[model samples]
Target chain A: MAAGDSGEDKLIARLFGSVATHPGALGLKDDAALLAVPPGHELVLTKDALVAGVHFFPDDPPASIARKAMRVNLSDLAAKGADPLGVLLAFAIPPDMDAAALEAFAGGIGADATLYGAPLLGGDTVRTPGPFTVSITALGAVPTGQMVRRATARPGEAIVVSGTIGDSALGLALRLDPARSGFAGLDSASLDHLRDRYLHPRPRLALARPLRGRASAAMDVSDGLVGDLRKLLSASGVAGTIEASRVPFSAAARAAIAAEPALLETALTGGDDYEILAVMPDHEVSAFSTFATAAGIGVSVIGHTHEGEGLSVRDGDGAELTLARGSFSHF
Target chain B: MAAGDSGEDKLIARLFGSVATHPGALGLKDDAALLAVPPGHELVLTKDALVAGVHFFPDDPPASIARKAMRVNLSDLAAKGADPLGVLLAFAIPPDMDAAALEAFAGGIGADATLYGAPLLGGDTVRTPGPFTVSITALGAVPTGQMVRRATARPGEAIVVSGTIGDSALGLALRLDPARSGFAGLDSASLDHLRDRYLHPRPRLALARPLRGRASAAMDVSDGLVGDLRKLLSASGVAGTIEASRVPFSAAARAAIAAEPALLETALTGGDDYEILAVMPDHEVSAFSTFATAAGIGVSVIGHTHEGEGLSVRDGDGAELTLARGSFSHF
Candidate 1:
């Protein structure tokens, strides 16, 4: 019954069809898209799914949710040092979701895809008897054999991270707290800054070129710094130590930590940072930092890779600190 | 707090990591996969999502659900005349789902991927506050510019379909019926056969090579033969007529229809056939049929294409028939 009218055909044409710009998309009419792999390049593939109530508040704006979905996958590609080509989306919408919400979600994804120069190639939309779920599979390109990968870092390499961390975690705290305005001394502007950071992730696309040439291993920090760093170390079969004080944090995050000392552990182990953690030789750090600075982003050397496995966090005095929880998990 | 223990990391290593056999998969260690597209081949990409209670019964066995998920996407690739390379899965599980269910789901998908030569590449698993949802993106390869397209059919071409058309729809009927066992003269074996058709789709991968060189236009029958044929004709700017008698049906479907003649329309338009429907010149039909027979699959010429629009169905007495509802839709 819905097939002839309000189903997939209408939804595609009305909301998301315009974003299928690539010739391979076949105007979103065909069963599959035909993508021509660029000459001398390899394709990078990544998938990420966002679920309502888990990944985001159920009432979060549809547009923001859409952007977050695409941004997270883009962050994965960015970590791999790949140039994004396009994305395929798979959406499962709750029966109660209105047309306005669906339209807003499509509009948001289309805007983000166009903004990032990666058009929507194809997608599947289905009905779910539950929360709205958005799953995206992003395709990217990198010159053959040039994809930056985890497990390639050598012992003694410096561990560098792109941009500041922990803002998103702190922002999420404020969002979940009932007495949101009771922060110790954080100004309204700082509060908004933290909230925005949680709502919108700034994926480090500009660092791809620099990291591809300089970094020995890389991964995006979706988990907390300590946790994600530990994963990278395990993958590379190397250990690392981070000076807790050296891990860059936003002014708002600093103020929150100052107000609640316990928040420092949350800052270290809180997920959703979306920053790029990279391992590079000490000599290449200055040049990489310079390039990142020119690109209007910050780069910090938090520690160095060692011969063993797992991550160690040290205070300013080199005293190792224990974390209650190492990373974020969905299980 | 599920991030540290029961969530992604542990689940992946225990359940799915071993399925990453291809070099591109990187053993699921990296953030993304590096796919080296073969020289002189283009990639075909398709995404499909199945939601519990919508696509399948929430209580269906995990293996059958996994197989159906992969088969639907494989059917899309088969229609496009593409060789499937790999698949990326995204799963959102309800909090109520036990570890056994999660393990069973992963095991089922892994087995299907191996069976299809579409090894697991990488995936994202998350928690959902609703029903289980599985989304997959399948990648396929075809020689440059050789993908069978839906808009290339010409007037005066023979329309053909592989396998029976409505067994799955009939199977669904029996599944939904409260008096499922009261069907007149239907034995348990016949009922199981019909239900199996609904649970497992046989994607025509063998048809790819034959159709690639012969079919003028092609697509998989997903939304029922009548509705899908209408789509193909619309895309190709042509019309077609089908002889209801020539439309293929399985023995079980024929028996069920004999018991209730009104079900003929449902057999023709209830969807979920997952069969290949192609348009080719009349001259190519015989050779194609022969090749398909040699490959151990049935091929039936049920209609012809003409220079017009929409699909026309003719009954036994040459009288035209109209379907009340032409396909299944989720809206």
Candidate 2:
């Protein structure tokens, strides 16, 4: 990172200007970006921040860190059933940060912005006392009044989640304490799968259009399924019953859990799963599943909404199970 | 300042839920905010970040810190000729921060959001190891194709500024080293006036409408006027000649400079002056000035754009003045 104001300006123009292809971005020379929302389309706004040593290790790959910053917000947009348009990034780093590292980080951000079709609109970079951090504010658009929300679920609706869960949690476990994770029996490939999931999350953006047209309510599960489901139920003034056995888990996660039964709790309440959780009428389940499967993403029916209050999870034998904790939190 | 996931959720709901009253905000229960852009309107986006011990004193009132975070972005919207619609905040703070401080910060943010008519749409809060930081992305709306740009200045256009410019810079000097600020001769009220300017910046939002209709180019002077004007001229592919004598200063600022002549450079090149700098056709200057005056804001012609390459500042005698530096730099 550069030390002064002129250096900061020059750094922005040289490192970030190329991504400001949108005309309204004004080539990033203007103070604010101009975004023309198509008629009848409403904008979706979401922001997420990643702090070194908390969100990711300080030595983590710059590309992965950048991708994570963008993906978290992308996950929010996906849950809202909107397509991303652009993003503004704010970076705070120690003044002594390597210039090459900053370049790599920007390159990664630009790469993901291009991949997700969310062009870089503009950004602010500044010096921090310690612990580099990145904050991304992503903008998207959906048809007027069509955004899927968490408070619209109703009784008798089927709760579905896109893609498998628990991998990220297990991945973190392995990354933090490989030997103590009790995954020694797992094959190397399984360990790699868990680790990779922790590094990058695939937001269910492809399901946005389908969910927007049919789902009653939706949100991205970032803070563990049980806790997030409870939040969703509370917001909708409803309750839910989730089948523990039906909660999708990747083969790697299944093996790791099989090696240690206590891992189930971690799978249940250890967040960082960037997958879409949606509620829809039971009648639309089959069609939605088919469409989702055809698109190469799994859509599993794991629960149902009810008129009561909180959330409960049932075991394979249909007996309600208790959890040690509800969700992953950073306070 | 909660300690875990559930705690974080509770904190957000308890402190911020009421402010997310916009229907599109979905009561702060959704993954992203939905904004229905009125027909024929475009969104203006800008993001600014403030770091503890960098942007402001870490001991500054939490409310002032929060207000500064939002006001800096509001200043950007003002320069863009847009009316703020909403704001999204991202906060990364030390986990051990006092709960009372967080409450005060939130209250301050809420107050400013209300005062600026930019409601809080959504925000993300997370834990940082050290150095608390706040990043605000403010969204605004302007009639389609009406956003003012910094690259639109043409030769022969008159350069204008809304409000006095040097108070903030001088105020910062006094705050940093009170005894050396050369303010001992000033009355207590004048000292307070300078200090207050440093703490709170009044963004020129009211000038947006008139500037949109008439200004050839516009930008907010966050950096010093000399550097910012150079940037504007560079972006517009034009040059300018500024009359230093015409640069406006507050009475307190003039008094301080009279006591220490060298403080003039600090007033000219030191940044943090959140005033609006604009260019307009000579013919529109009178009308624009009349409208600005009626709005109770001062508008002064300090320069003129020309078909050249760089900026030059001249005194009342037509002799060029030398500057130690063009602008305040953070590098």
For TM-score, the strongest prediction is: 2
True contacts kept of each: 0.93, 0.85
lDDT of 1 by residue, A1-331 (tens): 0224565548656677777777988888888888998999999999999998888888889999999999999999999999898999988878789888888988888899988877788878887879989999999999999999988988998999999898888888888782643355898888998888887888888898888878999999998888888888887899998899999998888988888888888778888899999999999999999989998999999999989878889999999999999986431
lDDT of 1 by residue, B175-252 (tens): 888264334678888889889998999888888888988999999998889989988899899999999999999888
Pairs that collide in candidate 1 are: A328-B3, A329-B2, A329-B3
* TM-score of structure candidate 2: 0.97
Cα RMSD for candidate 1?
2.2
Best by lDDT: 1
Q: Distance from true position, residue A299, model 1, in Å?
A: 0.7
RMSD of 2: 1.9
lDDT, model 1, position B327 = 69
Q: In model 2, which regions exceed 4 Å deviation?
A: A1-9, B1-9
- After TM-score superposition, what is the CA distance of residue A164 in candidate 1 from its true location, in Å? 0.5
DockQ of each two-chain model? 0.88, 0.85
iRMS, all models: 0.7, 0.8
> Tens digit of lDDT per residue, candidate 2, span A1-331?
1113556557756777776677767777788888888888989999888899888888888888999899989999999899998999899977667768877888888888888888888868888987989999999999988999888898889999989889989988988889964598889998988988888888778888888879999999898888888878887999899999999999988988888888898888887899999999999988888878888999999999988888989999999899988988532
Per-candidate TM equals 0.96, 0.97
TM-score of chain A of 1: 0.95
